[model samples]
Target: MAETLTAASSHGEHAHGEMSFWSKYVFSTDHKVVGLQYMFTGIFMGLIGGFMAYAFRMQLAFPGVEVPGYGLVSPVDYNALVTNHGTIMIFWVAMPVLVAAFGNYLIPLMVGADDMVFPRLNRLSYQVFLLSAIVLICSFFVEGGGFGGAWTAYPPLSAQSQYNLTPLGSSLWLVAVGLEFVAFLIGGINFITTAMNSRAPGMKAYDIPMIVWMIVVASIMFMASVGPLLAGAVMLFMDQNIGTAFFDPDRGGDPILWQHLFWFFGHPEVYVVLLPATGLVADIITVFSRKKLFAYRTVLYTVFATGVLSFTVWAHHQFVAGIDPRMAHVFTVTTLLISIPIAEMMFVYIATLYGGSITLTTPMLWALAFIAEFLIGGVTGVFLGASGADIYFHDTYFVLAHFHYTFFPIAIIGFYAGISFWFPKMFGKMMNETLGKIHFWGTVIPFNLIFIPLFVLGASGQHRRIYDFSHFPNLSAPWQQDLRILATSALLVMLAFQSVFLVNFVWSLWKGRKAGKNPWKSNTLEWTAESPPPHGNWSELPTVYRGPYEYGVPGRDSDYWPQNEPN
Candidate 1:
């Protein structure tokens, strides 16, 4: 499997310095340590995002009643929760886990680098990300009880925070997110440079693993798109602090500019997270099915195509924001085109499964789920991409369902799938397979319960971000009743469902079965090393003779040929 040692174990890159626990572990620049930092931080953020959603879901399903977990919901607090929920889910939960954790861990090892091109820069990026998380967490206690206008922080509503609720923590909310984006921007730079120039002998640009391809393209996406949001964040800071009027209408600033900037990074940010999962799916799909990825060039081209198209589709989110009718049409056309490449990719996956031996491990289960979940999300997205349908669907719970379907499967479920599949390689042990199956079923049943009804709500015209909806009873139909019950029931089940996963994840750390390296007969470079891999990944650097996906090749010793093997 792995014949080549990474730079960490290479002749010149070894470290022998004595170190204290704090310096060696906490502040270390080792990509593995940094990766741990990202995982823990992302889990922490996930808890926050999860709870925030729980709180708001309570408000929506049982409006006007004091909920058990939350006390009598104040109107301002409800809005604040919604705002924080969106912010936390998008920035903290998805990006940190996807970009920071996986990127830090895999990029160096897979590319045969000892560490990132800028190791110290990697450490500093995580530090800043930590600080950003802290600052955002602290915003909850701000005098007015955090920003209440919603996560997008639209102007008029978000700009005059004092007017609607009180500037409260509204001003600081921008700072928290602004800092977070900076963290990713720095992280992206490190990823791009490391992959470009740092490969072992015989590893060409195309020879790199699919996961690395994902990291490269995603980093490029992050670099190109995040600037506008950052500029918007700075303007928002000025509008709130220096009274710069960038978003203040009275002072001749347009609120819509803030949205334009936001969805700009915002939409591409979805792919920034999705591409990695797609890469993981490609890897997992081929490995478990005992076949190569169906069309390697097609996968690469589609990924490249999607990254470029992600930028142009940002305005689809802005369709209902009172933008020009012509702009909506342009966005509609572009958004639809982006889906073509994705549909092509989806076809590749479905086609690859045609004649392969499919295994159903936890990782495989999650990968299959990723396909199902992402497809649902992708299909729903079509309605929202068209200008006519979007005008009706935008700002409604329908939009909420649409993205959750995509992001949950793509980002949350996608990451979960990767982590579970890689857990053996990551932690050096096999998880409880039976328990894992139970966890998967728990996740699947409740997830569909939670998001599917939101589509029904969208059809009925229930707008998102509404704190109190008792006034809307007059417009209700029988369908809304069924949906409200369904969504509420699903939310409860979903929360309870996480416990199964948590228990399996925690218990497996100490009690699970021991696994040999390459338990899945995977062909990628990572499997050539020891289970849980040493500080330096390989004993010696292995020369590459073929691409990473050499499954079912005739005359091989086994079902797959390792990437580092000689022909």
Candidate 2:
């Protein structure tokens, strides 16, 4: 039984239109508006990223054959697309959309802050994010058509500065990433400050919503771990601009040093992006399952464990980079050891489902899909974690299939679930459930049709990052044109299916059925307020007595439970 604190709540900043259009639109500090800005930008970037993925997948599946309605993507353009794809997916879509967007929008409400601790700093963080986006886009029109080096931007290649970075394009890529990291660092600092110091009168550490906890820990990870990469990017820029020998092997600099520095932040960057989504799914599943999270404290511990483990596993990306055998071995142990936290959380998830009467709503459906599909990603992760095994799968399409399974589920499924879970709360309207289901099945079936076989071809040793995969130099494995047909056809179907979601998403705000404050009847401060909560969020500051996952109490009137409903 959770006790909710109800203090007199007030909506501040009732002032009406005190500023000009540019001021409010471009420089305003309101988190909700800022979040919406991030949401639209992230979605736009998703379209760009998805199309790049589709364009590349087409080339891989069918060499020398251009699809109708699309021109041939040149190797340089393909390189740009790949770089942009990785960059957009990581920085623009996953981090901004998942963490920055939701963190800004929901964290304050859940923790009972009227607004961020430093609202102007919050707005400036977003402006920096926008600047980063611009720099990245500008790189495309440069003489060499953007940085040809992979998103990893490894040196010797990136450092040659003559072959690829000769023009200012590669220089711009470094600048863009530098700014983006700064954006998050600022936002991360703001998030931690707001959560720790600005909570409602009585909300304690354990009393805050799981989403808040996820973001807080993720922020901490971002702060502690991001410096190496930030410093590395600076060193990289110097290699191109001033000839600092950080990664220039020709100048007695070690290229592997870049990988070490990059993945150092790069690995934890995964959790920085995914942990918020994981927290969102945890709340959504428990609410829909009509039970408390199986082990609340363990879930928090698991989040911390995963964050710690992430820093140690960075070298898993370097097994094939000629890293020392002893270092690789140490990394392998760290990588495998990270799995225990995930496995522990997994046990908690399935355990929650054991005696629950699940409501298969759109959010819950995505959560189920997340668990089942992520198992593939997670297990394959273990396979990659093993250094001896990874030497074979390292550069192959196997890596492709594995991360797509990982990233897509978190990005698509997590955001989609957040969409489903928060739609009512977001727009005060419920999207058509029928259409959501159609979109779900549309993506689920075709998603598998495309990626599963990629694993086969990958295991048979199909190298990644090539435009003409037929030249992969592995002819012993049966190369079939069928892969082309299946993958292309599946991709098209997936695109079309997502259209239903997009359409439903847009159309529902005005046309979908109206929703009540707590439609799903979940146990969280969020449900204690109105659907599309007012600017102030709560009628009163909500105090918590139990954990966020309390649901389906036997004596409850219906199959659901509300977080703050009186015992």
Q: By how many angstroms RMSD does model 2 differ from the true structure?
A: 3.0
Q: What global local distance difference test value does model 2 have? A: 0.81
Clashing pairs in 2: 5-543, 523-563
Name the weakest run of 10 consecutive residues (lDDT summed) in model 2.
Answer: 7-16
Q: For each candidate, C-alpha RMSD in Å?
A: 2.3, 3.0
TM-score for each of the candidates? 0.96, 0.94
Task: Predict model 1's lDDT versus the native.
Answer: 0.83
The residue-by-residue lDDT of candidate 2 on 281-386, one tens digit each, is 8888888777777887888899999988888999989999989999999999999999899888878889988888788998899988888888888898888999
Runs off by more than 4 Å, candidate 1: 1-14, 163-166, 475-479
